[model samples]
Target: MKSLLSSRPVLWFLFLFNLAVAVVAPFVVDGAQGVMTAVGMGVVSLGAGISLARDRGRRVSA
Candidate 1:
């Protein structure tokens, strides 16, 4: 798990992929629910970004 997270490309890929999905979600959803879908995605992406950052910091400190 630590090895995987230490890979810059993998971490970046996960971050971008989640954000991209969030952006595209609005188009895939129906009606006025698009806004809600987008917001939810944004939250998920943000959390992932934070987690990735913390993982990197731990690696650096160690």
Candidate 2:
């Protein structure tokens, strides 16, 4: 899991994919469920981006 998270390409892909889903979900779905789905996706995207940034920082410092 840590190895996967540390991969820059994979992290970027996951972040972009989740961001795309979050952006498109509103037009495809309806009501509170749609909003919740978008929010969840956004959160995941943010987490992935943060993880990538942290990993990069650690690599630089080490």
Candidate 3:
């Protein structure tokens, strides 16, 4: 579980997915939908970053 969360590929995927959503949101959706999508993407990215950091810390401790 810790190893999986700390994986660089997983972090990169989260980043890229967020980037893709940000790029497409403007073209496909407007106003509230765009804002909601943006917020959701941000939350996911932040969660990924936090998880990665936490896993790395756990690995270092162990």
Candidate 4:
């Protein structure tokens, strides 16, 4: 469980899940709810991207 949490697979899953939500949300929902979904997805994606970048930078620096 610890290894799984620390690895790239979890990050990939989060990224894909957020992307899928971003893509499908507008189709399934309407109006304000859909917009909020999109905004939340964007925030999640941005956080994942920043985490990936920081991890890569750490590896490179070390």
| lDDT per residue (tens digit) for residues 5-62 in model 2 | 6688988998999999999998899998889999999999999999988988999999
lDDT digits (tens) for residues 1-62 of candidate 4: 85775467787777778978988888899998998998899788767777777888999999
For model 3, give the 10-residue run with minimal summed lDDT: 18-27
The estimated TM-scores of all candidates read 0.63, 0.81, 0.62, 0.77
Q: Which ten residues in a row are the worst by lDDT in model 2?
A: 2-11
Candidate 2 to truth, TM:
0.81
> Which candidate, 1 or 2, has the higher TM-score?
2
- The C-alpha stretches of model 3 lying farther than 4 A from their native spots are 1-7, 19-28
Q: What TM-score quantifies how close candidate 1 is to the native fold?
A: 0.63
Deviation of model 1 at 9, angstroms: 8.6
Which candidate tops TM-score?
A: 2
TM-score order of candidates, top first = 2, 4, 1, 3
Look at candidate 3 and give me any clashing residue pairs. none
Q: What C-alpha lDDT, on a 0 to 100 scale, does residue 7 get in candidate 4?
A: 69
Who is ahead in TM-score, 1 or 3?
A: 1
Error of 2 at 37 (Å): 0.7
What's the residue-level lDDT of 62 in candidate 2?
A: 100
Q: Model 2 RMSD to the real structure?
A: 1.6
